[model samples]
Target: MMESAFTRPVARPLVVFDGDCAFCTASIDRIRDRIRPDVDFAPWQRLDLTALGLTEEQVENAVQWIGSDGGRASGARAGAMLLRRAARPWRLLGTVMLIPPFSWLAAVVYCLIAHNRHRLPGGTLACAFPGPNRV
Candidate 1:
């Protein structure tokens, strides 16, 4: 496995994902296997979305990263935070992804992946987002 700061409990940030999505779960599993961050994973269904100031639609659309200080990052920002916590090379890559043009592209890619996830490997028809809603 890769050795990194995240291998230990650096901050124990929470990664809230869609439990209803097989694709999302599989992706998370793959990330765990590769990075092994000392992060806590929880399904959106099992968490208090209201307490987190989140709605079902929000989580259904993208992954969420809740920092220890209560800072929140969603979509590509969340992905970047997770990747940046991985080993050195990955951290550098993550940093690169956060730059202007790359960041914009990453956000677009993240949205595309999320929207079409149900059609991807390990995903079912139910894995699609339920659309937006008012909080």
Candidate 2:
């Protein structure tokens, strides 16, 4: 099948997320609208995971970052990668996040947030989960 507007490869980095979650959607919107990073974001539901070298289980859990070179990062590392591409302050923080204790802390924090996102502001009932959210 021919690639439509949504399925083609991107020259820029791509951020894969779960569109079914309101919190996730809000977060991405805020960042894209306000921060204006040089990245492309797509809800995994509308894109082909296999073409993007992603898995349903991968995107269903946390946000994902796919660099133009096909490198991938998820969760906090993905966030860090995004911030690193942003202007000034965020870039600084992203760089720091790649460091020792900060990276570890960011990872832990990301997991916590990802699991509890359904309870966060802007979250919806469809995003709810009872047990562990990770796969």
The TM-scores, one per candidate, come to: 0.85, 0.88
Question: Can you write out model 1's per-residue Cα lDDT over 26-135, one digit (the tens) per residue?
Answer: 99999899887666778888876777678877787789987776778999999888887788787887798889999999999998998899999999988977745634
- How does candidate 2 fare on TM-score? 0.88
In candidate 2, what residue range of length 10 has the lowest lDDT sum? 1-10
lDDT top scorer: 2
Which structure among the candidates has the greatest TM-score? 2
lDDT of 2: 0.85
Off by over 4 Å in 2: 1-9, 129-135
Tens digits of lDDT, candidate 2, 58-109: 8887899989777889999999999988998999999999899999999999
